[model samples]
Target chain A: MFPSRFDLVVAQTVAEAVEAKVDAGEGGRFLAGGQSLIPMMKMRVAFPETLIDINRIAGLDAIERSNGHLQVGALVRHADVVASDATFGAVAAAAPWVADPLVRNRGTMCGSVAHCDPEGDWNSVLLATGAEVIAQGPSGERSISIADFVDGAFTSTLGEDELVVGLRIPVPSGRSGGAYLKLERKIGDYATVAVASHLELDDSGAIAAAGLALTSVNPINTKVADAEALLVGQQPSEELFAEAAELAAAAAEPRDDVRGTAAWKRQVVRTYTKRGLAAAAQQAEGS
Target chain B: MEVNITINGSEHASDVEPRTLLVDHIRRTVGLTGTHVGCDTTSCGACTVLMDGTPVKACTVLAAQADGSEVTTVEGLKGADGLHPIQSAFTDDHGLQCGFCTPGMMLVGASLIAENPDPSDDEVRWAISGNLCRCTGYINIVKAIQTAAARVAESSNGS
Candidate 1:
């Protein structure tokens, strides 16, 4: 399979990449790992007239903790995330589950977040971790919350000329834990249904901060705000988790598909949320 | 666009279209047919090759993207000392039946041993999870990698 003919611009810097995107207009795309975009191009699902290859751009592959966030650059591959000591919570848990070893070697976290596929794991992990996408355009850079950055399935709030330079996931100052649970048919397959859970326990052993997000259960990566709200100010218990899990199931807008019936998927979401939260709270307690 | 890549220790530079996949470039341009293309999609690792010593699906990588990198296909696995240890283990253990996915399996296995000289059974299984083998049931494939790892380790200790 071959993609349609397009001009390739190898950019040396972030400014050059943004400039190329502006020149290429709406038909242009910034090629990072090309794991998803290249396959789409081969299937003729996407026909970009120009491709701004940002692989050569230096300083866009850093994985470091700065200020109060774990900063992942646009070129930080999934494998890098798995290998990094700095990664924690859902980010580390979901890194090995993205595609496979080969795909993970090249695919970037920023690109996955930008792609915003409902089945994609990184976005849900980012959403649960309260990550931010750093967008760079002709007007300069600005940080957008993961909730606002993901506009829809396979869509984002990024402007045509704007490039996602990196993603910043907030670091938990207190005792916190995160976990990503994905149910896939086989290795490298898209998730049948996945859940990302985060928890931070207060000094009183109650939930101080909580985040819950679902994948492949809605048109977009859905964050269960109501469920998260239920978790906060509550003690860790099976009954408390069960109530929050029910709320997560309620928030799911799944459709019947070949993977499984909508009801079955929602059930899995409920079960996974409970299990994920328990595991997260266990980690938090250990921390 | 012109891409200059070193395959199997040989430098082969060519002019290719931006859409040209690295697998197509290796088989057609460089005439190295050892790397098979089972599924054009990234699902199957039949087109797996070592790009800068890291295994990646060749069909999904643009030839232009691998412009200045060193790629190692199945042909390159043979060291100065005859066949690679993994290749010898595969033949000895009957790791392949149809031999279609052999090239990809061997490359990934070799890569695994390179990074981890002594891998667990689960580690071997996880490493080759990307490559599919309808034959041999993956039992012998896993055994072959383990055997090769032991052989490599023994030789290093003896030396």
Candidate 2:
């Protein structure tokens, strides 16, 4: 059972949800899927005096392709996104592997993004894909790129009364492919180290652009721009991938934990980075 | 607050505490005890149910959040004629020994089969990863899901 007692307000609209939070002032917490918040409450980590349930708000759970990008509503569950045709194959693949099936069914992309756990799979994937977060506050709606939205672990740029309304992922062009790989000690646990890689190929089957982001290695998801730069203008041969993986390993700043030591995590990051990039390169070639 | 929700295709209105979870509402107020609460945290799938046709853990969802939604518990999965195919498969394959996790396993498994009737073994394993069963070692549970998938596919084809 949860420790704190709070008023439950079922908001019928986005406006109502916001108002409920504003009215509750500092004591209110917005509840979407509650995959993160409820667990915290049960552990006495969070003790909000009021809970604004946003599940009833219409038009907040949708996934569609729009204007050459995938626009996913905030309430769209991880399971729905994984099963939906709108998300690109690589992005969809990340959803099923997040936590477990029940969590995937209830956890939303926005919720995971907002939670901003260092080991969160969605956060790492969003960073690699250069996705944008859409936030709505009492004043108005605003959009922030994923890089700027996540400040650190368990933190985001969202204001007290702000809500994440949606996410926008730009579709890569011309034989682009992406993949996410994580090293977990066991199933349904946070990743010890994870990497999400996206590669775009030129007409000559050479890498045109690449994005690599590592999670659970630092306080926040870190984009290894230097490592990604190594892949450009080159094919993903074992030698090239080795260099990129080395760079990613060098760039990471993993911490010691029960799952693994910093050195072990660095090694896992290097290994998974190489594997993910290799697989992504194959997917790019096929495309 | 007073919330009106449709459970198992029946309308129910109950006055609950503000902090009451949907799992408690279903089990206590609606008198459907099939949905068990295994972990207070959201890690366990013992409280799994379908809210508006999507599988979600009831323990995490507040009852007020489900105010106007259509909820389907394990009890709701049965037709007037007999048990749902997933439930039948669980029995046929010996998916449960203690049966504490059976309700949630059935709910999540049914949802998985509903979405992908021909899930691979890997997919079947991935689908029920959240629902933990200590007694069965998950071997028969996986077989039960596959069995249910076959049954559902056959029934749909026959229909």
Candidate 3:
């Protein structure tokens, strides 16, 4: 099926792209990899009058490690994330779990974050890893915390004129490690329920810090603060992981869908969260 | 819109609609039909092609997006007189039953071998994870990829 008619505007720079978007008003959108947006267009779910192609724009794909953050440019593809040293914690680990190789070849992590789909691959990882989105508009640029960036299902705090330029992820330091684990119906399917856990261990092998978040279990991918708090100052143990998993399950607000029932998803999240924590904790110990 | 794309070894410039998918452009414009569109959605890798030497789903990419870029379809996988190593391996291992998914499977397999010359069976399966083979139960497909990896390494070493 062919998509609806639209004018394609290729922008050479971020400033030009933002201006074109502002000019096109609500009917305009900045096209990145177009993995998500193109599918929507093909389904006639979205019909933008103007698609500002930013692929030609330079400088948005640089992976830089500076200022205690890993700045991943918006154009940096998911495949690059896994192979890049700049990405740390769950974002890198979850890269392979993203749709599949074909999609990951072009789908950018910032595009995933910008899409803000409830079942998106990057949300749980970004939320748990405390990543921030860098949005650039006519006025300049601003950073929005991932927790605040993803407002709801398929929604973000991005202004119509603002384009996601990049993502600044806080560099996890010290005995810190993160992992993303997902349960899907098939190889390339979206998550039935996914968990991203970042754990930091103390010198005594006790947990010093933890960040837990789950995807597709709520209106938005959300952090399990209570579950994370439960792991703090506690030694890593199967019992501790089980308790945190239960708490994480209780924090989840899964709804029934084709994947499974709400209760079933909650249980899935429970077990996956436990496994994710164990992986992260083990990495922390080795680090 | 006028878009220029380098397909296989040829360069083509064509006027296309913004909505025209790359797979359509490759098949219709360049007349290369080896790339199949099993599912227009990104879920199926049937339309997978190498864009700038990386595997990307053609249905999700617009012809306009491939402007000034290089695309390699399964048509480019063969040698001058015989089948490509991956294609040969597929035929030898009986990797396909219907042949609808074979092109994609072979192209993805080639990509996998290009990236990792000696992929394990698990690595081969992971490489073709996006591609679906409804026929042959995927056992032969995995065997085909592994065999192709060996052939590719052998060819490279001989050269």
Per-prediction DockQ? 0.87, 0.68, 0.85
Candidate number with greatest DockQ: 1
What are the per-residue Cα lDDT tens digits for candidate 1 across B25-131? Answer: 99999999999998888888999999999999999999989999999999999989799999999999998999999999999999999999999999999999899
**Chain B structural similarity as TM-score, candidate 2:** 0.96
User: Evaluated on chain B only, what are the TM-scores of all the candidate structures, in order?
Assistant: 0.98, 0.96, 0.95
Under the 3 Å rule for N, CA and C atoms, how many clashes does model 2 have?
Answer: 0
Best by TM-score: 1
Residue pairs with backbone atoms closer than 3 Å in model 3 (clashes): none
Stretches > 4 Å off in candidate 2: B116-120, B151-159
Residues A250-275, candidate 3, lDDT per residue (tens digit)?
98988888899999999999899889
Model 3: per-residue Cα lDDT over B1-159, one tens digit each: 999999987899899998899999999888999999888888878898999888888999999999999888999988897888899998899888999988888888888888898888888888888888777448999898889889878878899
In model 3, which runs have C-alpha deviations exceeding 4 angstroms?
none
In Å, residue B102's CA in model 1 sits off its true spot by: 0.9
- Model 1's DockQ score: 0.87
**What would the TM-scores of all predictions be?**
0.99, 0.92, 0.96
